[model samples]
Target: MPVDLVPTPGAGPRVTFTGLGGAELIIGLTGQSRQMSRWALGFILIAAAGTALARRGCGSKVIFIVVVLTVASLLALWLPATTDVANGAFMAGAALVPLYILIALVQRLWNSLFVRNM
Candidate 1:
C-alpha cells in the first residue's frame, strides 16, 4: 500500500491514498491536534460543575441523567441540520444511554473525592 505525502501550508504533510474504486482519500496529519482539547475542556467544565453541585448536596444521579439526556436531545435536534437527518438524529438519541452511563460513573468518582457525606 503506497501513500503520497502532500505538504500543507503551515503544517506537516498529509497522507493521500488511493482507495477502493479509485477514490482519493486525504488524511490530515496536523489539522486535528486540537480537536480533543476542545472536547476535553467541555468535559472538565462539566465535571467541575457536577462536583460542586454534589458537594452542595445536589443529587448526582439526577443531575447526571438530566444533563446527559438534555445534551443528547439537543445534539439530536442540531445534528439533523448538518448531516443525514434521520440517521443523525437517531445516532445522537441512541448515544444517550452510553453517555448517561459514562457520565454517571464520572460524576460518582468526582463525588467520591469531593463529597464526604456520601
Candidate 2:
C-alpha cells in the first residue's frame, strides 16, 4: 500500500476517541477478538430469531419475545461469563421495539399529514 493510501496508526483512534461510544468500542476491540466474535455471533443469532418470529405470523408476539430477550440479556449481566454475549444480545433485543414504534409513528404521521386524498 502506498504510504498516502494507508492511514497512520493513530489517525483512526484519534477520531474514534472523540465520541464516548466510539471510544469504548475501539478500546473494547483491542486484543479481544474472541470476545468480539462471540458478541457478533450472539447478536446475529438473536436478530435472526427475532426476524424469524416476525415472519411467521407472530406479529403481536414479536414484541413480547423481544421484551423477554431483552430482560434475559440484562439478567445475563449478573454473570461475568455471559457478559460479552449478553451485551450483543441486549443491543439486538433492546433496539427492535423502539425502532418499530418509531417507524410506525413516522408512517402514521406521514399518512395523516402529507399523504394525498384517498
Candidate 3:
C-alpha cells in the first residue's frame, strides 16, 4: 500500500492509504503516534543527508555501504511496526536511499553530457 501525506485546510498533515481500502489515517495526535512521526521525520532527514553527500562526489562504495546499513536498520524497525499498518513508512524509508543515488547519477550524467567544457 502506498501512503500519501496530504495537507488539509486548517489541519495538520494527513496520511492517506491507497489500495488498502482508501482510508485516511491521522497520526501524531497522541503519544505513540507522535513518536512514530518523529522517527519518520528523522529517517527522511538522514536519507536526504546521505543523498547530498553522495551528490557531492562521495564515492559509490561508501554510499552503497551506508545505504545497505540504512536499509537494514529500517528493516529491523519495520518488522516490529509491520503489524501496525506502517508499510508506507517502511517503503519510503527504504526507497529514499536508492532514489537519491539515482538522482545523483542523473545529475552527473547531465553535467558530463552537456556541461563539459570540451
Flag regions of model 2 displaced more than 4 Å.
1-30, 55-59, 62-71, 102-118
lDDT of 3 at 50: 54
Model 2 scores a TM of 0.47
Q: Return the lDDT, model 3, position 68.
A: 49
Candidate 2 structure quality by residue, lDDT tens digits, 1-118: 2223356775645432455454322123334898898788767877787665553443664765667586666667677667777778777777666755666678779989998986
For candidate 3, lDDT tens digit of each residue in 80-102?
Answer: 54323343334454666677678
Roughly what TM-score does model 1 have, to 2 decimal places?
Answer: 0.34
Q: Write the per-residue lDDT of candidate 1 for residues 56-94, one digit (tens) a residue.
A: 333564656476546646664786332233333334334
**Ranking of models by lDDT:** 2, 3, 1
Native-to-model Cα distance after best TM-score fit, residue 71 in candidate 1, in Å: 2.0
Compared with the true structure, the alpha-carbon lDDT of candidate 3 equals 0.59
Question: What is the number of backbone collisions in each predicted candidate, taken in the order shown?
Answer: 0, 0, 0
Q: After superposition, how far is residue 46 of candidate 1 from its true place, in Å?
A: 0.3
Which candidate achieves the best lDDT against the true structure?
2
| lDDT of each candidate versus the true structure | 0.52, 0.66, 0.59
